[model samples]
Target: MEIVPIDTPSLGDRSYVVHDGEVAFVVDPQRDIDRVLAVLRDRGARLTDVFETHVHNDYVTGGLALARATGAAYHVNAADPVSFERSPVKAGDLVEAGEAMRVRAVATPGHTFTHLVYLVESAGEPPAVFTGGSLLYGSVGRPDLLGSEHTRELAHAQYASANRLAAELPEETWVFPTHGFGSFCASAPSAASSSTIWRERQLNPVLTRSEQSYVDEPFDAYPAYYDHVAQLNLAGPGAPDLSFPRRAGTTELRRRIVAGEWVVDLRHRAAFAAGHVTGTLNFGIDGEFATYLGWLLPWGTPVTLLGETREQVARAQRELARIGIDRPAAAATGRPGTWTAGPISSFPTARFADLARAWQHRPVAIVDVRRDQEWRAEHVAGAVHIPLHELPGRLGEVPGGEAWVHCNSGYRSSIGASLLAAAGRRVVTVDDLFERAAPAGLDVVSRQVMA
Candidate 1:
């Protein structure tokens, strides 16, 4: 038996292909299934089944599409309130695939009420379980991700569910989870990609914490896009529309901008800061584009692409697809020279040293667009904290002054600076190391280490 981990690094999610010689089964596929098919081809195995741990809230699932393409049975929780047809799987149900590969469904409801973990073993080999967004490598999946009302009930369920997995599964049983790393779905990040049941038992605090305290895990804020994703998944967001968006001409692109369509500029930070189409969002093609772009783009809002090449635009679309962000209204390639009527707008960018020297003479509002954890670790004493994803909606919170934006890295700060500029604010980006805050003559504030 062979189990392969297919990673979607942008979202920090992993799907798997477990096969025994001739037949294979896919777990929690992303919307783009070409790689999954390619893996099958490489292994010379026929895909016979597709398993969904739950109706995912993070991204669109490619289970239905894969099943349809490969003529495989799609398996999901029997209790889920999804509209699409799926082979209902219940706890303790054993399923057979290929000559020796066998799967046992273990319902684990901490992550989602209908979540399941599949334990796959073949011909007396030790079992490996696919724990999708349930029990991760270090910390377990967050319970409050669903909502406030369901948080208490689901937190208790998650505790019991975790303890059950530890008690029932053998120590040597291999564990594979879909969320960890940088995924917001995880309670905390893990150092490793995969772990054994024994390792998780020894390290994970969720299994050891009191139910009440664990339930009280304070959630700062979830992405606004998350509010709409669950409903779309429940309604069975079938397959992404196969038709590619049309290429927009200069006239057409300008019209879309006038129509209030978001134009995502996928150039690098330096290039974007140097010059870009005014009001176009600067989530570069080279950075953590998927997560932030998915978080920031309002649901069902039409988007157009402004990139350097057709491949660049298509590459952006590919990353967006992993997060269920399809339906790009149109794409406009190349630099703004031919695509826009007005000259490209450029913003002033500063390194920490220059920012420091200027801060002594003029009080510039420092905007830090990192996550809550990053902010708590260390930040410039009086810097305003609005995460890049939240900046579009919460622009009012920023103080009125000459604004200088910076995240841990320059990438996010550049994006934030662009947004601030587009909103008619006077902004410049501190496009350098965040640690330079102190040397730059700013009072550095440090908070408690994240749990």
Candidate 2:
């Protein structure tokens, strides 16, 4: 028996392709079915089953499309209200894939109301459980994604569900989870790349803490794009069209920008800051390009991609498709100078020391655009707290002056700087690591100081 894990690092999730030599099954695939298909082809395996732990609140699922392509039976929880035809599975249902693999659907209602973990048993191999969001390596999936009304109930359920798994599963059982590897779906991040039921029992707060304590854990805002993904999943998303968009010229790029459409530059942040087409926003294709772009860009707005190469544009297109932002309206491949005849706009990129020096000389507006939890942990003294997702709507709240924008890393600050610059505010992106802020002599304060 072989289990291959495919990771989508930008979204911080993993999909599994498990096969007992000839027959293979998949769990929690992303919208790009091509990757999963390639894996199956490489193994010379035939796909027999596809399983979804829940109606995902993150990326659009590729289950329906993969099933149709490979003639595999798609298994979704019986309780989920999905439009597409699926082999509805419930608790205690046993599914067989050839003679070597036996999968049992165990209902684990924590990540969502209908989440299930698929327990796979094969002869000589250790038993492996695909614990979708119920029991993560260290923390369970956050319970607030559904809504506030369900948060409390789901939080309590999450605790019970985790305990249930720990109590029933053997110590050596391999625990595989779909969330908690930097996904917002997780209540917190897990440093472990892999874990076992024994490791989880020793380290996971969910198993060790009281039910009331687990329920009281706090959550922050998730990506705005999350509001649309679940609906798209319920409606049954098909395979993404990853073909290159129509070529866009200088005139078209200008017109789109003037019309308030998103014209995203897919270059490195440093290159973007050095020089970029006027009015184009920077979402460097090298970083978390799709996540922040999908998080900030108004849904359904036409987007035109500008990349340094055709390959960059194609890569960006594939990333966007995972989150259901299909077929970017247009694209161009070249340097910023080639995109516009007008003067290329440029911004100053700096370190925390630059910011500190400027602050000492004169008062400057510091916008801390990290999340609420990050802000509460530690922040520069006098920095205004405005999470990046909220910045587009709260522009007026920023003090009228030059704005120094930053996040934990410089990638997000570049995005924040671009938005501020586009809105006609003078902005400088602090492109250095946040760890340098204190060493650079900036007045940093902790949550205890604020309290």
Candidate 3:
């Protein structure tokens, strides 16, 4: 049995293609199905099955497309009915892969009513479990992700399901989960991708707690689009009709950017601040890039991506497509000619030392782009506060004039700077000034850590 991991950078998602001899099964595939097809063809394997662990709420799934293209069966949970053409899979249902491999569906419905984990049993090795959102590396799926009323019940169910798996699987059984680091499915600070049942039992916080304790833990509210994405995943979207022409060069990108198209910077926040195409918004791949982009920009806005590297461009395109942002005009090569307005000037950033000195001479407007809770605890003296999400519409509040912007890190400041610059205000970004000032008398403010 051979397992290949396919990383989708746009969504910070990883999918697996498990092949045993000439038969292949794809697990939790994002919208880009061509790559999976290519891999199957190269291995001379005929696609036999596409399995979804659950109806996902993050991005569109490609299981239906892959199944239709290859005349393979699409399998999903049987208990909770979905709209797509899928065979109902319940516990003890065994799927055969030639003579060496067999997959057994295990109902694990805490994440969703229809969630299932596939237990793969080979001829000689300990069985490996494909735990989707039900069991992540260091965390279990958040129950509140479904909604408020069902949160406690689902969390309790998830706890019970996790406990059952921990007790049933042997210590050495390999665990492969659908989500890992950077996935919002689990809360922040998750561990790496593969872990053993023994490791999770010893170290996972969720595993240590009782069902009631797990359900009682407080959590932030789920995003608005979660239900929409979940429904789309259940009834898979049709094949991507990405009719947008492939961008040829910087010249074409600039024309689109000027024509009201959104230019998404897929680079890290720090890299974006160092230098980026003028007028472009930095939606780093780490954050909810696709969802936020859809919210901030008008729908169907032709997109051009500023990826970290050439290889990442396709990943970015697929990511946007996963959220239904299909018309990507092109990927930027970080060349000067890409921007018709030339390069947008970097915001004038100043250090705390420089800001202190300047403060003595004239009033320098300091805009705190941190959250309201952050502002209430501790912030720069007399600084105006505006969260980055609200900055675009509240530009009038920022008293323009050599304005200096700062966030916990420079990411938000860079975005603030772009909004201010687009509105014709001179701005500077102070990166990580909060972290740097934490040691000093400067009171760093956060919900968890109050100065």
| TM-score of candidate 3 on Cα atoms, chains taken together | 0.81
Better of 2 and 3 by TM-score: 2
Which tens-of-lDDT digit does each residue in 330-399 have in candidate 2? 9999998889989988889999999999999987999999999999999999999999999889988989
Q: What is the C-alpha RMSD of each candidate to the true structure, in Å?
A: 2.2, 0.9, 4.1
Q: Give lDDT tens digits, candidate 1, residues 292-400.
A: 7778877778888888888888888888776677778898888878678887888888988888777788888889999887887888777899988889899988889
Tens digits of per-residue lDDT, candidate 3, 60-83, equal 788888889889888877765577
TM per candidate comes to: 0.94, 0.99, 0.81
Alpha-carbon lDDT, every model: 0.83, 0.92, 0.73
**Which residue pairs show collisions in model 1?**
none
Model 3 global lDDT (CA atoms, 0 to 1): 0.73
Provide the lowest-lDDT 10-residue window in model 1: 219-228
- Write down the lDDT that model 1 would get: 0.83
Q: Which whole-number lDDT from 0 to 100 does residue 436 have in model 1?
A: 81
> With candidate 3 superimposed using the best TM-score fit, by how many Å does residue 46's alpha carbon deviate from the native?
2.7
Q: List the candidate 3 regions with Cα displacement exceeding 4 Å.
A: 79-81, 221-227, 241-280, 284-295, 298-315, 329-338, 341-346, 350-403, 407-409, 446-451
